[model samples]
Target: MDKAQIKIYGLLENYLEYCKTNGFTDFEIWCEDNIDSANEKGLVQDIYREVNHIADKLFD
Candidate 1:
């Protein structure tokens, strides 16, 4: 991958780890409270679906 992609992946991975280790796991409530736009929420849900698709294959 390119340098930008690598950096973003590293940052996201770290953020994911931080969230997992901390008490920020209530994603449904978080989204309900934080996501102000239905369009943005839909986009994020699409991302969740795509990520879960790959994760199910890779980690199953």
Candidate 2:
């Protein structure tokens, strides 16, 4: 994985933890709410794709 991919993966890891800790059952909803935070952290191109990819790997 490239640096961006790795960073996104790490972010998704944290997001998963956040969801588990906070009782959030919907990944899409969490993404909708927190995508801007990812953007603010410098995610741009392929953000959704990358996030989905990481999420699938972790949650599937």
The lDDT leader among the candidates is 2
The digit string of per-residue lDDT tens for model 2 on 1-60 reads 766566556766777787556644444445454444554345534455555566566555
Global Cα lDDT for candidate 1: 0.47
Residue-level lDDT tens digits of model 1 in 1-60: 755445445544644555556633433333444455566566446555454454444444
Angstrom error at residue 2, model 1: 0.7
**Model 2 vs. true fold: TM:** 0.43
Report the number of the highest-TM-score candidate.
Answer: 2
Error of 1 at 60 (Å): 23
Badly placed stretches (over 4 Å) of model 1 are 25-60
| Residue 58 shift from truth in candidate 1, angstroms | 17
